[model samples]
Target chain A: MTVTMGKALTAALRDAMREDDTVLMFGEDVGPLGGVFRVTDGLAAEFGEDRCFDTPLAESGIVGLAVGMAMNGFRPVVEMQFDAFAYPAFEQIASHVAKMRNRTRGAVGLPMVIRVPYAGGIGGVEHHSDSSEAYYAHTPGLKVVTPSTVADAYSLLREAIADPDPVVFMEPKKLYWAKDEVSLPVRTEPFGRAVVRVPGSDATLLAYGPAVPVALEAASAAAAEGLSLEVVDLRTLVPFDDATVAASVRKTGRCVVVAEASGFAGVSAEIVARVQERCFHSLAAPVLRVAGWDVPFPPPVLEKYQLPGVDRVLDAVDRLQFDDAPDPRFLAVSP
Target chain B: MTTQAEHRMPAVLPGGVPPADALLPSAEPVRFLDDDGGPAPGDAHGRYERPSTELLRRAYDAMVLGRRFDAQATALTKQGRLAVYPSSRGQEAGEIGAVLALRETDWLFPTYRDTMALIARGIDPVEALTLLRGSWHCGYDPMATRTAPQCTPLATHAPHAVGVAYAARRRGEDTVALVLIGDGGTSEGDFHEALNFAAVFHVPVVFLVQNNGFAISVPVSRQTAAPSLAHKGVGYGVRGERVDGNDPLAMLAVLTDAVESARAGGGPVLVEAHTYRVEPHTNADDDGRYRDHDEVAAWKRRDPIARLEAHLRSAGELTDDDVAAAGAAAEAFAADVRKRLSEEPVGDPAELFAHVFATPTPQLREQAAWLAEELAR
Candidate 1:
């Protein structure tokens, strides 16, 4: 079947709720109004008001209630209207939902998923376009997953729902309208596994969520330049597939991480650190990153410049190509 | 205790109970149990038949163990084993009473000081101590025991309780949520928001405010002008009541009614458990700096545990030997917990990055890899 990422997600949620009596879906405008994105348009009608409903304009309340419900044996999937709007509930996510299992010595589980529409492409205002996955990924006890393809959007979401832990499921708002052929499997796949969206050998490009498309574009452009770039989509953030990433990086001897979050202390920093550690000697050049600017996501007019693009990845590749040279930038640096 | 020191007393209502014939409704608190451990006149409000002997014994034992655990935690703070400890020494009855009123399926949202409530709910005292020791985040699974994490930020969990109640009611589940906060917490926006939400939605949640007369160094006088925290719920259209927090029987009676009422779809209730913080706010705080010694001594005479013990002994429900045995057992249990706590390995710093997400982002994986290498070096 061919479907947009948004439709796929809605179908995935509907199907999951249909399969599990305990499954519930709730968020702002998710009921009679559907969602702002219309991803949850018919859920309330299909599941009844009891299973699918709208919550008060309190993000914390939505998440906290989900935690309580999950504790009580309900599978709650909450939707944050926007990425930035999720900050109010971040405390609940970090202090309660994430740490509940470990804090209780595995006596309790937070089998809930929080769906957030994130990232910019449609020129959303400051609050709408922000990418906050790094913040969630930074906190322990949460599973941060983002899907780049229609199939991944459907399958990984079900996997998130089935996992007996809190999962932050981020859907790229910009990619919601992007359509692709999807095979809706009867069952969901396991989480924490990375997918090689494109295979190559000269260099590796690590990306996830919205950036996967950007990395694919970058890979296509790099291919024309005779650079065989391996594009790796990190399906899940918390229990990242280090083996997959390390294997790719080790083979290529060069890697470039891409993300829409701010460059400083972002997911890119973590990827760079890991690559440097595991494949330090294998590095043809320092692991490079193509990410958003350190400044806050700029106004829509400037966001295009702030967010990483195909040109940025190719630029990073250009830097890696000069690894044999003492690179003027490091001339005075001690080994 | 000092024969009512004859200094000009705050205007006392002529009758034993404040006269209802005031020009305006008097804000004087209502109490079912008196300071002398006797039921007051017109105390027919929500008295319960005495719980089974087994339940009473369990409650008493749990209170003793909770107190012991609190004391051991305080000592551990002094011994440099814990970062800090909040003592629930004199306020055990109110906490235990409320817990006893709850069904196993009901939920509890407790604050940092409600260790007694956690113990009454069958949570291992040592597990809570682990959080205080900074070895873990929250000590127990809120789902397994129908309790939320002990919220340190004042009043934050109140809304959570309301939300849970709303969810339960929406699902047609006859469950109730009891959220415990302090008098100081009543001042937080979350408290008012929670009360308003609970009332509007007719959610089955009880806002149990343990009015201990202070928020850290700030006295109750400075916290609010309302005669009682319970009155705050009135504006939100929720039933509000004040109970003798020191009287375990009285608290149990009121809480049972409140819990049952909520389960019956009677909407939210606001319960003000008027008590005192007999110890410093925490091991790191010094109450002497803000409160006088005399005031502390005065409140000590009205201690909740002591009052409950008086009632129990006078009623022939418990003997001195029983109390002594419970104390000895609690002390031994505390010692064992301390030993176990000491032997438990410290958490690995690398694990700090482990649970943030179910799967690590390529970026986080890199950071963890770097941290791993740094640790190795």
Candidate 2:
């Protein structure tokens, strides 16, 4: 059946809650309001307030409480509401949620999921649009995963909540409304594995979350111009599927890491560094990155320029230094 | 030019709002022991029942041992056996009293200075010092002991305690969590949030604020302008109380009431124990730089261990031989800790990658292998 990414996430929450009585869902406006994006719609009505509820609007308190609940054998699924708003809970996520299991020598494991609606493209005023995955990915103990497809949204979230560790589940806000036809309980590739969305023999366009769709669009657009672009979706960011990514990059002989977050010391930068180290001898040219500019998420009107789009990705692909390349598709679509 | 009728409005809140006096702490710190460990003046002893003689004697013994443990840990820092030690020398009453008030099935969320309480909870002295010894973040099994890792970041563990208590209530477990924080932690947002969450959810948790007068060099006055740290709870709809932190009887009675009240489904309670820090925040700090030496000397006279010993003897709950036995036991424990900590910790280099996640990511595995190769070379 066709389902939006938001609906798929709600179904995942419902299924997980139905399966495990210890699983709880709570966050700002997540109960009766069904969350701002409606990702948690119908959950509070279906499940009692005991299983799903709203909390006082304190981010640190929300995450900190999850740490304690997890310690006491409860699986808490919390929401940060938006990407930028999650900064207030960074200390809790970084110092407590991520380090609890390690600090306790595996005696205490916080099996919790901090769902963050991330990325910019919906013309959100300011704080609503941001790519904050890099912050979570940089932390060692956290498992960071973002779903670009509706089916993965249902599967990855379930797997994340089931895993005996803390996971920072980044939901691309722009793709929440994206639709796809998939069955319920669609168990896709497990986390830490990248999937080749559109295979090609030319350069690889590696992306995750919102960038995956952009990379796919770029690949299709490049195809019309005689350039064969392979699209790879990095399902999980932390356990980065190096083997899968390196294999694709080696076959393609070139790579372009794409992400909505800023390139300066961002997840894209890490991906580029890892790909080069793994496939250095096979690389035909230096691995490039198509990422958001190193600036605060811009105003709504100017977000189109700040966020990585199909043309920016093609621009990076154009720089791959192929032996006999067609006229630059980047120049044709360059703004 | 507003009229009285215009000024009046219908109340939006639900009925059964608790009286402010019921939630607010006592006007003055409660005490059952005077300067010489005799019955306190006025109605102080009438307000709360003194703990049983048996419990008081147990507290005295634990305090004696706890004080010695604190001293040994501080000395370990000087000997390079521990990286640093936050001594709970003068706060033994609150540390031991708080632990004695709870059952083994209940949870204890302690701060860095609450190692004394960890010992009271029967954690091995060597394992308790592992964090300070730089062997691991926590030395003992938290799941087995029902004690959280000793949190260092101020007030960060408060919300965790609230969550644990809330979970216990939901699971129909009569488990209560006692979170130990300092006066300075009351100013933190996490502390306030924890109290608010606990009260709103009616969770079974007791926030025992060891108001040892300072968070490092910052005095209690600098930390809050509230009448008392306990008074901070009333705003969150939590019952608040104050006790003389150095008085073991007062600490035990107040904390026991708070813990039992919570376990009885009376919702969360916040008890602020008025006390002083006779030592510096940590061994690396110089107490002289923060406050006058005379202040420390004055608080030293109100020592928790000495006061408890005097009180127990006056009540005939302790004898000279019992006091000597407690000291002997403390000495033995301190000796064992000293010996255990003297040897350097031998940690597996690969352990650095363990526990980061249930399943180590490929990146972590790769990094661990690289480190292994480097160490082998």
Q: How well is candidate 1 docked (DockQ)?
A: 0.16
Candidates, DockQ: 0.16, 0.50
Q: Residue B252 error for model 1, in Å? A: 2.8
Best by lDDT: 2
lDDT per residue as tens, model 1, A133-248: 98998887788899988888888888888887889999999999999877765343457688888999999999988899999999999899888999999988767888899999
Model 1 lDDT per residue over B1-377, tens place? 10112211322234563322211111444454466656555634343454555666666777787788878878877887877778877788778878888999888998889876887788887776667778656767677788887888788778778867766776678889999999889887678868866765677898889988789999888989976778787676677877767766667767888899889867788888878888899888988889898987887777656666666777788898989999999989888878876754488877665554444455567778999999899
True contacts kept of 2: 0.76
Residue-level lDDT of model 2, residues B205-293, one tens digit each, is 99999999888888888988888888888787788999999898899889999899999878889999989999899988887878999
How would you class the docking of model 1?
Answer: incorrect
Candidate 2 Cα deviation (angstroms), residue B14: 16
RMSD of 1: 8.4
What do the candidate models score in CA lDDT, each in turn?
0.79, 0.89
lDDT of 2 by residue, A1-335 (tens): 99999999999999999999899998899988899999889988888777778887899999998998998889999999999999989989999999988898888999999999998889998798989888899898999999999999999999999989999999999999999999998899998999999999999999999999999999999999998998999999977898889999999999999888989999999998988888999988888888888899999889988888888888778778774554353447655
Give the C-alpha miss distance for residue B186 in model 1, angstroms: 3.7
Worst 10 residues of 1 chain A by lDDT: A321-330
